[model samples]
Target: MENGTNTQSEGKDPSGFLSKIIGNPVMVKLNSGVVYKGKYFTRELQSVDGYMNIALEKTEEYVDGTKRRSYGDAFVRGNNVMYISADS
Candidate 1:
C-alpha cells in the first residue's frame, strides 16, 4: 500500500520541482509556446495553491526597426509549466 501511494505522489507538488533549483536558472515555457531561460529570482510559496512567481531576465527582439530590452517578473501558474531543470 505504501509503495503504491508513493508512486502516485510523484510530481504532485509543483514547488518540489522548483525548490530544488530555487536560486538557479530553470526553464519556463509559456502557454503561447514561448520558452525563457533565466536565473531564479524569487517565489511565493505561501499562496493558496502554491503559485510560484519567478523573475527572468532575457533579451527581447522586436519586429520593428529597432532593438529593445525586456525583463520582468512572470506570474507562472504551477500547472502551466511543463518542466523545470537546473541551468547547469
Candidate 2:
C-alpha cells in the first residue's frame, strides 16, 4: 500500500507544476505571515539552494489577519517562504 502511494506521488513532478505557472501572477506567503504578490519569476525558482527570489510588486505584512504595512518591488529568500500560489 505504501509503495503504491509513493510511486503515484513520485510520478508528479513539483518542478513541472511550477513551470506551468511561471510568468503568471503568484502570491507568496512567508512563515512570518507576510504576503508578496507579483509575476512568478521562473529563473529564481530553479535555484537548488531553496532560496525563493520573488520579483515583488506588492507586499502586505500581516498581523493577526490585519495588514500592517505595504511595499513595492523586492526580493525574498526561500527559507522564509511558506507557500506559493497562483494569484487571480
Point to the candidate with the largest TM-score.
2
Q: How well does candidate 2 match the true structure in TM-score terms?
A: 0.59
Residue 70 local lDDT, model 1 = 46
Q: How close is candidate 1 to the true structure, as a TM-score?
A: 0.54
Tens-digit lDDT track of model 2 for 32-63: 87776676545655552435445554555556
What C-alpha lDDT values do all the predictions have? Answer: 0.53, 0.65
Model 2 lDDT on a 0 to 1 scale? 0.65
Worst 10 residues of 1 by lDDT: 59-68
Candidate 1 lDDT over residue span 1-88, tens digit each: 2655655566676666666676666666655555556666544433415455455444232223243434555455655655555667
Measured against the true structure, the TM-scores of the candidates, in listed sequence, are 0.54, 0.59
> Each prediction's Cα RMSD?
5.9, 4.6
